[model samples]
Target: MSTPQPQTHQQAAPAPNWQSAPGTSYTSPIPVTRTHLGHALTSEWTKIKSVRSTMWTLGVFLLLVVGIGLLVAAQTNDNDYADVPYTIPAFFGLILGQICLITLGVLVVSSEYGTGMIRTTFTASPQRHRVLTAKLLIFFVVAFVVSALAIGFVGLVTSGMHGGASDNEWGGTVLKGALYVSLLGVLALAVGSMLRHSAGAITAMLGLVLVPAILPAFLMMSESLRTVGDKMMDYNAPNALAKIFEIDSENGGGTSQLVLLIGVTAAAIAGAYVLLERRDV
Candidate 1:
């Protein structure tokens, strides 16, 4: 007699493996995050600070600003210059300081190309417009901040030499100077992007800014040529910007000059963007 076999229950059929099943997937429940303009800005900011040129250029700006201010202050016993505000001797250096500022501005773009880092920049930020816009924004912000500090120092130091200017007046002037410097920086960025050559852009910028002043001098002999040159010189765009900082000047009476400067800057930026979009990088 076979002993009664213990009831052997077959184990329940093995559960199917959900992960390896034909129709099943192991998707993560979390959503993927994307980078934003702000991230690009931050990355650019880091790049700017890390570069040696950033420090050297900014230092040159500061030294030229302060050194010229001190020199003018020491030279002038009484403010005789009607071209600039009598209260601040710093305006004497404004023209030279602006040149330095423009060089720094152009380098911000040109340096990257020189180093071959521009390729990396484009790689990290495939969107060209956003990348250019970010560069412009960051450049403007840095220019504004640095110029503000430099102008503030100029005002304070000038105040010690001459009686302090009105708080309202100095505040307005300083704000204007900072923006003025920043606008030039923006202009340089655009030109640099378009030209893609630092030396060329810098030379062109100098020619643009200076030729208008010098051509009028020579053209004074001809009435029509003189008229055009005079208009351009009388335009005195830089002087107009200085007036914004100093509030009063003999040559700083035109309001349209600033509008013209701003318009030119905008056109350059737009032109650069368009060209950058159409051309191969």
Candidate 2:
């Protein structure tokens, strides 16, 4: 048996430096803040800007789009435009420039996977979906803004060269083109997330964009496949951009193309979420 000892009282917990939410108490002295989408956006923006890939890709994109656009504008006279929009010049440059944006989209997610940084990212965010959402949002915004500026600049130059009386539609057309390119990059990101390999995702995206335009020829050879071939030819990315600029007027506007791409991107993103939540880093 042991000798009895005097009882002691426990001290109360210290208050946090900041006030807690109503009816909730946090005992730790260190201040705590709730996480939200803004935090994730900031993190993603920081990561995207800090990398060299973003710089190189965006730089090349601007150079090709702007340079090619100006060159085309300089060579063409107002009569060459006829019923077409002045923004038509920008379309040629974007045909090649979009590759850079697509590549950047693939690098955004796949690079993290390649370097084992996704594990750290998931550990930090905890909610895998939030990180994915943040990446999509961030990439879309950057891609859209940069694309708009470059396209807008080219449009302005083209309009200045051929300042016809009826060239008032440039603003709306420029925004629409930018939207298409940005969504394309987001689709690339979705593909990157699903594949988790940069080259494969990029190649797959290239095929997705290019094959439809080319395969239509072979597809058209079959009378039964002709309808499908016609649709693909009409709705392919190049034609979509061309349609937006009024360069492909006989085929209707780009509204169908945008709607189709949005649907596809939504489906790809849904699949990416499923894979992200189920698969280990």
Candidate 3:
């Protein structure tokens, strides 16, 4: 009351040092690491796993490959497998299942473009080649692994039910069939990157697989085109798969199909790289 308290003045806090020292550059608090292909792969893996469409497509693929395979196996007796591998049943299912993989491959890349997410992807990884490579590798590995698992499962199930467990060739046959199916997926992915529209790319790939398979029959009416028609029928997706399973009349092993698919995929990938680099995302 009586004594007047001395006034206290709080000195203002010195200005925060937001600026760097004269000779030093400010370092970010977060650590920075140099990016490489591994980083790109990790990113691609994350993207593929997070998408719902991937799950749905793979789900449908397994359903077709496994369900139809089991159905085929159930309908047959041991005699049906006398000359064929237990994996033969899987071939019938895969004929349709391959379409699922093809569709998924197209959606993988083209969907990004459709949703305007490619810009974000490109911004995150400026090396378009690296990005594409990551996508290709991830997609191929996934396709192959899933195909192998589904086909192998059916083979094992049929062997147990109908008796072909001792056959040594089934393992190699399953691997070869899975590889063929995966390559088809890779080709579809390459096509997707180029077309960048899900519907268009899907249509184009369906045509690539289905058209050649059909044209041969129509072409046979023309005497001049008969030779070409025969060749197309022999060298096509369904034929290749049939040969792999030893279910076709031609009995040609599927080497030519593998070689042909590899060449086409390489060309498409090369083209994808060029267009990705040159075009605006």
lDDT of 1: 0.74
Cα lDDT tens digits for candidate 3, 1-281 = 69999999999999997887799986799999999999999998998999898999999999999999999999999888777788888998898999999999998899999999899999989889999999999999999999999999999999999875345467877888999999999999999999999999999999999999989989999999999998898879999988888786354577787788889989999999999999999
lDDT of 1 by residue, 96-169 (tens): 77777788779888888887888898888888888888889898888888877777787676666655333335
Poorest 10 consecutive residues by lDDT, candidate 3: 164-173
Relative to the true structure, how large is the alpha-carbon lDDT of every model?
0.74, 0.91, 0.90
* TM-score: model 2 vs. ground truth: 0.89
| lDDT winner | 2
TM-score between candidate 3 and the true structure: 0.89
| Over 4 Å off, model 2 | 1-26
lDDT of 2: 0.91
Clashing pairs in 3: none
What TM-score, to 2 decimals, does candidate 1 have?
0.82
